[model samples]
Target: MTMKDPKSYDLLSYIVVFLGFYEGVLPFVAKSTDWEPFLSLPRHLSSPAWWIVSGLVIVASFFSLWGIDIAKKRRHPDA
Candidate 1:
């Protein structure tokens, strides 16, 4: 049996990408200085853990979009 690549990416994947972009930028633009490293996101952009989380989400979203394009190309090479 030949496995098929999905013709389209799911809605949740798009949502993640949006949320990820927000999560990644929120901390950087936050004006508040009193934020807990682990509890507060908008104020903890300086935290290494936060950076890692943000980077992961952003990269994941980007790759998700890229994968969607690849899948579409494979399914419809003429398009």
Candidate 2:
């Protein structure tokens, strides 16, 4: 967790949090009821909306990772 190392997970977080939520919730939701954990874009969703949404999601993800890195640095300054 050193400042130099900036210990932070990347792809692992994405798979575990995002995809895991999708997998766990989607199945149970459908089985219990007709609920959906999430949904894809509308068939007619505009390209600008798609790009803006995607860009924001990507930027937010990067910020999350960056914050984790900063936290690790604070937690274990000499790591």
Candidate 3:
């Protein structure tokens, strides 16, 4: 029940990490007079705590693809 090594999963991992990093930083860089809370919420949600959760999510997402690859490999070991 191990995972398979698929290039697509790696690319997706990079994309998700990039998106999470963007979400984590955009709020801080945003400017406004009274839009404080909304902007800050994502920053908060993107905190170390949430980052840990999101990191797990990215790993799980990678595993999901890995699982698919594993199944495919089981079906066609030559591939």
Candidate 4:
């Protein structure tokens, strides 16, 4: 089967990575600092919904990277 655009996958991987970092960091920052809106975020992060979201982010990142790898392999099979 043919792969989709590698650049698109690469961009998506970058975005997912950024989001994963944001999700993981927000609660820590919220707890450690005095930001008003951020302070409440940490409390909600303990919920199952946040966990699921984080999991999905991780999965998306993994898949995107995998796709990129496949595309690179297809592009340079001899490497």
TM-score of each model, paired residue for residue:
0.52, 0.44, 0.38, 0.47
Candidate with top TM-score is 1
What is the C-alpha local distance difference test score of each model?
0.58, 0.48, 0.52, 0.58
Model 4's alpha-carbon lDDT is 0.58
Task: Pick the winner on TM-score between candidates 1 and 4.
Answer: 1
Candidate 2 regions off by >4 Å? Answer: 1-44
Alpha-carbon lDDT of model 3 = 0.52
TM-score rank order:
1, 4, 2, 3
Point out the higher-scoring one by lDDT: 1 or 3.
Answer: 1
RMSD of each: 5.3, 9.1, 7.9, 5.2
At residue 76, candidate 1 shows an lDDT of: 61
TM-score of 4: 0.47
lDDT of candidate 2 vs native? 0.48
- Model 4, position 55, has a per-residue lDDT of 56
